[model samples]
Target chain A: MALDMKLFKDVKTIAHAGMDGLIFYFSGEPVQANQRVQQYMLSINHAKPDWLKTLIPSYDSLLVCFDCFKVDAHFVYQYLAAHELTHAVSIDGSHHQIPVWYDSPQANDFEQIKNQTGLDKSEVIKLHTSYSLQVFAVGFAPGFAYMGELPEELVCPRLATPRKKVPQGAVAIAEKQAAIYPFSSPGGWNLLGLCPWYYELTDPGDLPEFSVGDSVSFYAINEKQFTEMANDR
Target chain B: MTDKLPIGFVIEDPGLCAIIVDNGRDSGLDRGFSEGGPLDETAYFWSNWLCGNAEGEPAIECIGSIAFTVKARAAIAVTGPDVTLTRNGNACPSWQTLNVEPGDKVTAKSLSPTAKVYLAMSGKWLLNEVMGSAGTMMREGTGGLDGKGKPLDSGDCIPIRIGDADKKEVPNWLQPDYHSNEPLDVVPGYQFEHFYPLARRRFFSADYTVTSDINRMGYRLNGPAVTSDVQNMRSEGINMGAIQFPQDGQPIIMLRDRQTLGGYPKIGCVAPYDIPRLVQQQVDGVVQFNECAASDARTKWLLAKSKRVRYLTEK
Candidate 1:
């Protein structure tokens, strides 16, 4: 039992996550960090090996919530030594082409983003619609997805003071993450556009096509298109 | 009165934080919705049991004068901290089932030392289900009278399933004496053994007062500053009742509406049965946390659950 833990000493660090949870930390590169955690999460979900219950993946760590009565610390140590993080990216991962009304009247953040970053309206829009980002994690608010590690050139800071209420469907970016206001709630992210498609994309499931580990790309659309999608929901 | 599977209750007042809730949206956790049920489950179940309603039935929870008028005679129960309950123009005691006549006014409020209260109707509330829950996930904008997580507003009519026309109060109203100084059962989690021995000792020996800062999300405790050498712990799913140590050394007991992922290092989880009594503690109330094994906690929970089921079924 002692030697099993010694074999994987440098690869990962295992610790108690909670009464029924175990935390596994991996010192992996940024590119494969989330996937590595997801791989571990999938194993617990798919196999429930050793009485595993549920798995939550974050940056480079995976928190495994399990049935404590069914397994012990020895079981976790052996499991960690036996299984390794996989390299297989999900083939079923989806890409959503979200339409946006950038810097429109309601958004009114184009000038804000421009002044803060010294980038003009078109430049901001170009950078925002530049490429799709993956949903790294979902939290803070229900249906709120954290899409992240925005392109370095486009990274922005949070507002000086958060608004009392950021209307739903408002697209914003802050630090290294971008998120859409799922419900009309207070937030500090710097607004860049309004997707106006929240109802269309946020029902049936917490997020329509915005599952974690999936990718999303934005496309510039006229106000008319935005209104149409807004009404579509 | 029209015959319907769901009985209707018209709202005359929508108190602060009033919403339709049940056991919670536990299944919806993976789908990005937090499990937002009642903060006081023991009180919630007591209300349901008094009204002969089964488990997982929807009910109203609030902190103010949540008044309503019924279109038909109905049996209902309210439970929680002391509240000024009025049936029509007559004052009434809570914690037991009471029958109300058509047009009878029902209201519950606590002006001083306010705490949450649960009102369980004889029939479950009828509402559009989101992920199979009528309980409102306020942050998610789903579930409730309207499909948008809004609370019962003035003039709102809630549909409910009608049941046994005869109404009888429970044999005895449980006015359990909950001593704030009593130790809250804590289930030792994975990180329990890692906490400093002295810190663990202080946590058990000392009494932590519930701070004024509280909500459906969690209750913040102010007491012995518990510090851990590790900072910036990775975020993960925080089960209801987990005592989390945030950046500041204070421990916050995550409740039903807690965020899906939290970064604070949690020392342990409160036993599920203890959460009911924990939620009833008023602001500045003193509470002591005691460590117990998860196995013991689970066994106790199962036994209590079975006892409640048997009691309700036989009744």
Candidate 2:
């Protein structure tokens, strides 16, 4: 099909995110408001509306929820403002690469992020594996994520006390963001190492090798390729 | 063969914080999970319709003094807030239906301190449903009955499907009072007009206390700060009983293991039929809040789903 392009065109406010949800709001840039919230979550999850249920998508809105006994929020804001964000087709998610290790031993703030970004440790793994970022919010846990801009000399600042554990796939950063955690909780970010990949759901549409407008990249491995990808996980 | 025989129950003690909930985990909120269910959805739908099950099935929940046992003939119930239950030691009746068998036992006992209970049984447990939810989610360790989300301790077991009893009860207009001081309601809606209308009239004329920093992801109140001129925005989706705030504006609420995404400033949600009386109140208790409209919270969730479809079609 291939030709449906009008996009959230800066919609601004749909509101209500409560009595059975419905956020929307689009006002621009954060990669075009998460590419119009991943094209309105791929056209309302491909119009599967049995009064939808949960859609979520963040970094600039698209909550949704529905099904208060089959609809409301003004019939889901007039079926999402009478549709038309166009889509002959768009997909673009899953991009990964990952593989960190940034000198593992969970790189406990590798010398306090090389003295708060004066950039050492191989220029903070060459500006955190130079560009690819963009997940911008998976959440505060479960395959964590939140990746982003960074590179203003590798940002920094988080961990004024917050590390009661932080192990699983660690790799972190703060300010302009970058993350990884994905299950070994209690973290305060700023770590910088160990990414033998983690998060594991196993069904109910599984997901999470990366999500939320996905696109990763990192790449620096060692410590025996993080012990052969943590013994091939 | 009699629904492949197995039946459930085992945890002989568990006590403070049992788990295995249900009707949660779907589309794991875009990969961050936390919809672990039943922080008192009307005492988990009257403990799954007084154990004739299916008000979202899979049960247990608990909090402070559990027990368990059974493993053959079943049918259960319990419901919460000021819990009690009992069984082998006799005293039964929390919201009705009981009948056990095999090793029997039962237990429950919270009596307050913001109870929590639930239990529910009557068939269909056979666990395994991780992200589609057999619900435990000890903060994403994942579902339960050893799907690894941990919590119901002392021996474990679970499995299910043998059911029987049929006794039921719970009618005093489907019981749920938990000492009803009432207020709660609140269908406000995200950022509810960017606050400051005297901070939404001190959030519906303030009272708020409940803060032992509650759990199952949120509750925290403490009272009237409200603020919200909407600063750093962008980070959204949150809903269950929502409320939010935090910049010392104190609020919190968002339960059923919350955190799917946030950025503070919420001032909404709450009316899911008053989120099980504010998750059964009691830390320092005291609550209040009102404004409900959104079609009167969808006609109080369609009259509580038409009283669970007229008590499951008159049983």
Candidate 3:
């Protein structure tokens, strides 16, 4: 059955208020529905009016924030209603390999996960790298993006206690979601690997490089390459 | 271009961290930037009024005491809780402007009580505006004089535009009370209904005490366990005054530097006007939450803000 876009009109209206924004609730299975929502938002973004700033897709719904001083909530509601939305669908995806060094002595949870999942280090790396992932949303810290649906074997709950600071470029996992830490900060996700990609600051002039519907892959590199990339920047 | 004269003095020492702040950055949270500015808005406004600056103009947020040597004559005012001013070693009044000679040594004493203080001068300070605010957010390392979130330190010379040096007296009516003890008004959030009904009842009826764990990021409250059986929640965008009840069941009121979004269930948000009351709350201070209708709350908020503007403009 196709998804009904009309069901979200009230939520979209409240979200347009630009004050304390609204959160829309969608009833569906978690993993499949979350991906569908992302695809739906991408279509909405493509058809969005020039006046709209951005439409963000979350796990279940879309968040739309506008400049209240310029446009009111009613106009936003009308705009969403007029646009016919495509049924959410996951597109055929491409994978970008992330070179990870799980061999570091500081790999705190490395041995623990190996113990729990009964998979050798090489098998673990193969499982993580082999799958193609989608960038679900950018949230939490600045430039921090949540991408997901890890293999069922790799899905694990977050650490009971979060570390005070997770280093920048650290690739971590929580439940079914895999993410890369854009900046060094405290987090609860299990550390698995690291990446060297930088999320550019939001400049009013520049287009966002990654959006909800885009595909992302991770490639692991050696310590020497990591140091070189760090210095080059 | 005319050379602008630097005006102002630090009478009473600014002890540790102090910086000029106005309204903070409107965006940048998506990139994980924290909004840094005066922790106490009410005091910040009063400080601006004392210096003869209009509302929204830059005012010095003295985390401790600020002492400065005046290079040019200018009128300045000190406001906020528990701050004492001394000019050339003599005590001075707060919420009122004082004219000083170019060589006067102005000193601000450590807040005997409150955590922050505000000092505003008659003319605007010379600082680059970054992300549309003069406020500083040191965590993301942006905004402030150099746009680096560095606070005012000793030996740092701040330049100020010179206005009428002769204008010294602050009208009696213009002086704000600076002391307001009232319960903060919160508008219930949409998720208010999600929590167990009994927990919601207990939340409204209980009095929470402010813990010492307070900063620009959040205020962790210690009170009756404001719990809910709901543990897991998808992360979502959070507002300025959101009252988040983490799994620990202790309610934490998020402030300016709070994460852009949160997963914890929020009971509601304290009204903007009542934010000052939260900022002024001291460790162990007990405060009760009162519900306000959204429409009435917004109207009262606008009126209060307008009054603050008028007070700043009064001669």
Candidate 4:
């Protein structure tokens, strides 16, 4: 895992997230860009930059919060250019297979999504399960992992008017991204189905299930399996 | 029943958005938990101070018209906007510590011209943390005593550690001036240059009104609809006080419970020190933004934090 510190040399854009925070923008697809951000963070972690506070990696950006009292933004930029610290730690590569209960009654907007995409219920679910999509980013709510690049066939606009409450574990899609609702919240994404027993992954020996680089694939399951898995959970 | 028996306050009424909150300090964002803390830091700290509780201790933040019946004597501090606080039909002064006797019903109504009020008890409200925080994040359905994101309802008894009879007051020098018309300090954001020069100038000079749709997550500022030339920016990591520009061009100040990432163009972030004032601003209240250098903002922020620490530790 070799990383070139020079890859960050262009540094074309830096946005102030807050007085103490700065967002360094990158140009690439979600998977590559997010991995680069993680690598960048790992490099910084190894360097142990004194001014660093927190590192938040998003789709195409790496947000850095610093101790404003100790060092300003100018110093960060200067330090990065002056120092030659480029080391990459091996990123865990694993795809979490999640069983989804598609086209269930709780999936309120499946019919609407089908009509919008001109795809039947089974076709839509097949298209969704076909791709091994990466966990691009997770935000909007806790454990809400935004997986990406839904097959063009599955690409559809979000609900014109969002639902008041999209239930927890809801598998949803809008534009190019799909996600599972960690908790019930007001949302606009087209509800596909619920992930059976998907939650705060208790798996040990590694990070949580939805780290930025980890991939995900959904498998269609019947309502009976959904109920059984949920009960087991 | 004896006076020595430890008794708690019974929630006779859990008025608008009344819920238990603490410092809610968190480092669990990697695990998908946002730091959910008080909306108004000045009020939260002051309430804790006057009630003899350390910073970040648990307390009740009442939005409007909260009533509680005390089962035992307790020292309470009602802080925040100029809300009307009453105990047993008698008017009481706020921004300082007050006493609650057994069977006494304490109530707090609106600030009318104000925003929220903090009812801090001398005893610490005890609740099991769901994800390193005690603040009730209703949207996420996690946190608080119930662990179900349920709002405080009538007949709920807030659990707290019983305290001694001695009560403390916030020194006059330490008392904060919650009301001020000074310009809010906003550090320029990354997309600041995306705005037209004229629009940027107007954003700094124009008066923005605080909209009624304010909450712990964010505040909608109603003023000039300043648009950015950049149309489709990718979502990035968002922090507290990031000012976002939507298609409507109106600015929204993101706060404590704000989403971790957002796609909107940001004009700038309102300075952290000024956020307490910004969040407590009443609906339609006029506010003006003043842009400052990031270095200056940090210096001021450190000074403010140090001042609070000095006061707390000195006496």
Candidate 5:
């Protein structure tokens, strides 16, 4: 059976990702791709099928994981073709205004980013927080959000050699994206400063504060405020 | 309150790596958490089944040599590839339940680094589930004994509900053959057709060796490099057992502990039923890929799952 042309206008391909996974490759810009992802997520979540397990959203695709014992890729494919995703309920996400301690001691790459972007430390921080950024994806590590469309002047390449250990809560940028390291893992992004906020998994219901398509903006904070705020948490 | 007293085993030696694992978490994929669980899931379930515990009960997944001391009478089982089980210096059989007395010493040793061993005890393991799973994600630092994703260490005592478990053994017909050399089945998807026909052909025909660079995250296979024509692709969500061909051509099968997203072009994903065979393969073990239809792959997966459930209920 073929996919419905009317329902799958943005879907470039509805193919088997694996035995238990089906991927929906979307066409168009990142914004449109994410919209398609949100629509599918909403439609699938509304149904709350037992076979459906997880939905992963990326920049240009949506991966749907199902219980292989209950359903096959074909079943999911046909289900997707039948679901009227266009009528999915669209809802607003929470807006997060995070605080960052720029020029902190953890900002080892501050000078490097300044040299690469041809901007001063304060200017770099301004460009980063100038406009609200959208979370394009969340991966690489737990709660490591990939927020995008960084200002052109702030775009910088990843380090040629990644550091062995990047501190947790490190605010960083690379290419056209900015992110925070929720855990102290090896990373290559240019570190601008550290954020007071972080994601920690303590309970089954614990989730990252942000999800894909959520809007986030950062504000500069002094080290004293960063320390006090961190301690308070 | 008296029944709630801690009763279990203490790790005497954690050799190599050992961590507590369960069936794994179904959620947290969107938040960038991989579905961390036992690498060799077939043996993991068997280990639990022999102990009369639910197949998804939290068990200990270990590599290399591990030794533990029981603090209370309990039934335990170990299963893995090329593993030697010993109880108080006397060699014991694996894949069957063994009753141990207090202060009894049990050890499991795997000669190969490529394979892992699983140890499951009767009764429920006392662990706080994270995201509905006790399976440990070391990278994410979630789940496990302390819910910090730390591997089992010497002197670490694991608490459990001590209960009577009858003597049981897995039927011979149900035991998995870890030595099988059959080619793993792959259900091609995501940029599969974009790969040149010759590249695709090479992937199926070529022999890939399981490189030493293997872990819960992924296995880097050394073989013919199959390059894809698709370039400048946006990073997207990666599925478990997804076969990715980076710029260098060698295929990397993303496993349970893989990152939530990746940018490399993928040819397809390895069938879930064949993943155990791939994970159990020793380093330098030759592996080949065979194309399988998605429907056929799904049937195989369902059959395996049903077989396990059938045996679990029947026995």
Candidate 6:
């Protein structure tokens, strides 16, 4: 079945302008915005129509990189436009609960959050652990996903000086965004907790664990579980 | 297994920083893998051309100088910057193929003016392709011979697959004039309109000096602050040679090793053909940016590519 052609105007406009790539800006009520874009991309991917090459959706934007050699930008642009016009409703109910170790000392920004929120360590953990964050985008580092919309009280700015080395599996918050560092590297985000789950670099042939539209809810895990998972790998 | 040759390089003395590289792995950036390639691309292409190697074959990107003793006779080419090459104490021409006898010593000198150099050999180097690329991404611990990005060290032996004795010479027309330093061409970006008109005017007109803070990631420039009136915006996918103006107002030209995305307001991207000049510039060397039509840039790119293709096939 052909995707609605009108949805692709933006794609055409961008391609005609000679842009190698284009970022689509999506806006919906905050409550359903994340699910809307996610479902849109998934449906496009699952349908696997011959014309579409790649359809990537983030929290508020969808990046579509087309095969210029096979299909012109206009074709891809029309596909997106038709798809968006036909599927306007939110696609809800695909959620994942990710286990995080908030109490671990390796959680780099624990003390700073306590100091800023005027909440004791326990209160900070409770606030962070309870909230279900929507996966806003997967970027910055490979498999490094940005999950966000933290509880207002737990909202914290990034560290004044970014740590030279933020350990892998670090769960950090910057502004309204909370992210897990899939790999150890330099980061400026304020640390809150550590997730035992490996977000990146799976062995060849292994399925990619996370999708752009998936929701990841963090649950506190004990040190034993963290070690067991680490050893299991 | 017997047919598979071991790719290795024995470093007599590790030059400033020499490492094995190939066409960077397709990171599946569509799924989030940053494209990592050589810092100096023009030289990278020339190096590959010298040895008649196909594009993406593994080569050595030497930062300063690379001295090595070849255990087996091989055909190799050295390109990039302005570096002197010597084989067993006899001076050799840069940008040409040479037949290195077994046990011969190859030494490369530091760039007198440019920043990096490239050395390529015929036949694929016997190295493992990490994430589908041999190029090293040290920051991500991906790519390179071991899949852990590390510069070549003393005593590291790189094995090369031997090719049949099919020799081709590089024509004089195909050789690039390393001395002809040119200004980079840029196409204004989305945020270019946000900069103060004066800042925009100055950007195209003024001269900016490159700083020592240059690397695979980015080149920090020292020049008059190109101020902007726009506030901080969300980070976006940055292209290679993206000229970004941070809060300090000094522009940072992102390079090969640059992050996948950035939030800084970008003025625009430098044309791919112009990147070689930018990459090779010495610290404090003055550079100016000239805006060109996209069609014009594309035509230039095609012309350059055609010339390169002719050079490759002529020999």
Against the reference, the lDDT scores of all candidates come to 0.70, 0.74, 0.64, 0.75, 0.81, 0.67
Decide which is better by TM-score, 1 or 3.
3
Query: lDDT per residue, candidate 4, B1-315, as tens digits?
Result: 223334468889887778778776445554456667888877788887787777788778778668999876788888776677889999998776788888998988866534667888887666777667788877666776576667888887777776753556665555445578999999887688888999999999999998886778788888888987865355567778988876677888888877777667787788888987787777888899999877789888888878878876786
Candidate 3 chain B least-lDDT 10 residues: B1-10
Clashing pairs in 4: A15-B190, A16-B190
Alpha-carbon shift of residue B140 in model 1 (angstroms): 1.5
| Residue A136 alpha-carbon offset, candidate 6, angstroms | 3.4
Instruction: Point out the higher-scoring one by lDDT: 1 or 6.
Output: 1
lDDT of 3 by residue, B39-102 (tens): 7776776666556676688877766567888877788777766668888789988766788778
Candidate 6, A20-111: lDDT as tens digits: 33445445644355555555666676666664434445455555544443455456565666764334444353688777776677665667
Evaluated on chain A only, model 4 obtains a TM-score of 0.79
Q: Which residue runs does candidate 6 get wrong by more than 4 Å? A: A1-19, A29-57, A62-126, A151-164, A196-208, A219-233, B1-9, B112-114, B165-181, B196-199, B224-235, B245-248, B313-315
Tell me candidate 1's TM-score on chain B: 0.89
* Model 1 spans > 4 angstroms off: A1-33, A36-133, A148-181, A184-208, A216-233, B1-7, B110-113, B165-177, B188-207, B223-225, B229-233, B306-315
Q: Considering summed lDDT, which 10 consecutive residues are worst modelled in model 6 chain A?
A: A10-19
Query: Which scores higher on TM-score, 4 or 6?
Result: 4
Q: On a 0 to 1 TM-score scale, where does candidate 6 land against the true structure?
A: 0.80
**Reference-based lDDT, residue B92, model 2:** 76
Could you estimate the TM-score for every candidate?
A: 0.73, 0.36, 0.77, 0.82, 0.86, 0.80
DockQ of predictions, in order shown: 0.23, 0.22, 0.23, 0.38, 0.47, 0.21
Using lDDT as the measure, the top candidate is 5
lDDT of candidate 5 at residue B83, scale 0 to 100? 83
lDDT of 3 by residue, A20-129 (tens): 33334545655555665565565666776545544445656555554433454445555665656665575564544555655544444666667657766677778788
B211 Cα displacement, candidate 1 (Å): 3.6
